[model samples]
Target: MELLKKNIHMNRQKSQAVMQVTLEEDFNVPDSKADVGSIIQDEAGVKIEDMKVANGQVMVTGAMEVEVLYVADNKERKVHRLTERLPFEEQINMEGAETGDNVQLKWDIEDLSVSLINSRKLSTRALLTFSAAVEEIYDVSAAVEIHGDGEISSLSKNLDMLQLTVQKKDILRIKDEITLASNKPNIQEVLWKSIQLRGTDIRILDGQLDVKGEFFIFVLYAGDDENGTMQWVETALPFAGTVDCSGCSPSMVDDVELSVASVSLEPRPDYDGEERILALEIVLDLDIKLYEEDKVEILEDVYSPAKELKPVTMQQVYESLVMKNFAKCRSSERVRMENNQPRMLQICHSRGDVKIDDTQVVENGLKVEGAVFADILYITSDDTLPFALMHGVVPFSHVIEVPGIDGTCRYSLKTQLEQLSTTMIDSEELEVKVGINLNALVVRVHKEDCIVDMEEAQLDMKKLAELPGIVGYIVQPGDSLWSIAKQYYTTPDRICRLNNLESEDVQAGNKLIIMKTVEITD
Candidate 1:
């Protein structure tokens, strides 16, 4: 007897770890730059350089780029930007991790603090969190059919499973330019800029993946006029393209994630040789995972009337997608400035960052709790410091309805800032409106016992001869026709034909007649 088997491809997370570290550095202002008077705005970004795995640990090396916008301490009191790079190295302990294993790392800036140490010196500190996961792909072989003419009686089961089709990492480079409007002034020097991805959508197609999104860019620069006035321009750029992905089709399910890896913005002259075009080169990293649903019939149990068959079975675990949902949460709050802070004359620009603090699984839903950190840049009342920055935190709690959600279900949630705006209510109070989008995917894991192989041997003549040839039986709970036929060393068709039964449906306490038949060999 031979067993026909099928292979199922899958991936599992081998090890995962999360760590937080604080990076601090002190810098002295260069001689070319003026002394630091007061800090107006600060931003920090984390870039990973290299990661090495050995001896069940991952050594990560990276640098944090910090930019500080402050007022000069000289007579001009103008806004000057100071940039620095702080390097960091850390080791994360992950058990069972080996070399050549695929590792994924994600990082976030928890908090950033900048303080004026002296007239010419500054101190900066940033708290960052790094999450690492190692994934391993493998295949499982299951027996689907038995090929032999040995009077074999087998039981089969139909299963709905998900098969992994494509797993890869790719980069999408987007090159575009944003031109200054006719009413806006030409750029002299760009002091600060912010770039963010909004409303991004990714879909799977035949042999490719479609990506569409809009990115918002805000630039604060000094104009080229005689007085060198400071001007700001903001615009949204729409992007649409296709990525070549082999073995991808519309029938497959995709769980692809896209993130801004790095961004480069440079000022270029337009056709008239004026600095009116902002050249943008953005690199987006994508993590792709595609799955195809399959319906399979596999042999669960097997027996032979002419021989002894012992089947080997093992428990296998697989994941099936349950639901995918996209939800939105809207919130508004009023922020009051402190008594010692400067009074706001007019609001210039506003931006926000979302951080998810905790997520809990409730009855048929998920509860998410987080805060939106808003940074507002506005014009001050004083002439010496015309621009000032204010920070506020708006807490939000929302429940996303996910039917059939449970604690055992595995889920992933990604949050982004959809829209943020601020309205000045008074000189000291500002109303902030926030719109957030949440994307969630939930999957359930199943464990099933499957037969992999079987061993066959000759049956004893004495034991075979002692069995009864005919009998009357009463069906009990949890009893099927296949089980009764297997117990009596007969076939289900023979029993049904002798008892004049229409179908194989058997109920408890039902009467049935069974007969045994032996194959005659010449």
Candidate 2:
């Protein structure tokens, strides 16, 4: 018996393995240094320099930079700064990983320890953690076809699918000089400086991407005075440019990550004294990935009328990567800066950095918990030490509003401090107001049903012979017109016409008349 057939073929990319691995490392200090001191404040910065893949493994190389400010042994304790750089190497075992695959790495400082070895030496231990993921992308194909002799019926559905197109890396640099205000003091030494991104907007053009944003540059400098007083200044540098991305369009979605690679500072040429002009050099790295949004038609279920048919089916529940924009949130905190150094002081300069420690998805939003590390330089109430600095940590929690979020969703969130300012409420309490923005890409998992295969079903001749020519039968559970027609060697349309029925929906315990017209052929 010849059968009708329909065939379809398409190419798809599937991720074979998505794995995460963590690594740790440690280092020590040398002699001739101050021993056993109380750590006033410390901060650690981690970055992944490069990644390479070899036989069955991925090699990651990176560095961790740590800065510590502490009080050493003296008649009166004073804050002293110490800095160190630790290099690390780790290998994540991926059984089928090879060159030309995609690997992502992020590192963090898990633990840090400091202890005294002797009067002149100290021992330091640090635990560093690195997480890496190796994704194997391969081609996948599926074809749906109908194979039968009689009329066939089927169902279809539409689905939104995400396809990754390009992944690349590039460098962007900013080299220019900025002049300090006339009222501010000259820069003798920089205590703390932070470069933050703000009000970033991106657009797509012909063969390129347009990026426009402003850099919030904040600097706390020690003035060249008799007591080396501290003061702070801030400026916003607006920048606009384009990056070449061949065959890019506005319809596609892109993810761009910007990071500071290196930074340098120098005194402006031919300028001296309080009329301060400083030169700055900053190098930033950009990682961009493009994705195409597509809608696909899928075949769900099928049936045949004249011929006995058996259709094969398969079900798959998959995650679609979706980019979502969350509403900006503002939080306020009050820090009490009183620690026996001075009391009831006047604030000179204040700056802080916000770090997100944890994130949890909630109903139509995200909950984040982190701390703000701030250093405030102030004028003491007494006349002994006019300029002094105090360090404090203020913890905060905020909920970012985003729609269509649930517990099963996986996401990667990027957070930034939009605005930070401080006001003196009292001699002991400082009122700090902070604004934040949380951008998220939520990967939602959706389930769909599909029909994969179909074949002609064979019937028994002995069962057909035992059936009466005209009979009355009662429909039972799980009964269909297609099945009953195939049993009596008739078509569903002919049965419906003979039984005076409008449709093929048969209910259980319903009485029906059956006529079997089978010419017995030997």
Regions of model 1 farther than 4 Å from truth: 457-469, 516-522
Candidate 2 per-residue lDDT, tens place, 262-369, comes to 767665533444437777887777776666677666555455434445655555554565556755767777778656766657776566666788999878878888
RMSD of each: 2.6, 5.8
Pick the lDDT winner.
1
- lDDT for each residue of candidate 1 in 1-522, tens digit (9 for 90 to 100): 789999867556679999999999999988888898999999999888898998799999999999999998877788888898899999988898878876778899976998999978889898889998876777889999997985788889987766768878888999999888898788888899888888888999899999999888888888888867878888889998888999999998787778888999889999999999989999988888787877778898998777888999988877777777889999999999989889999998888999898999999888999989999999999888878999888888888889998976877788988888899999999999988888887777778888888988887667667767788999999999999988888878878898899999999999998876753333
C-alpha TM-scores of all predictions: 0.93, 0.73
Lowest lDDT sum, 10 consecutive residues, model 1, at 513-522
Assess each prediction's global lDDT (C-alpha) against the native. Answer: 0.86, 0.64
Clashing pairs in 1: none
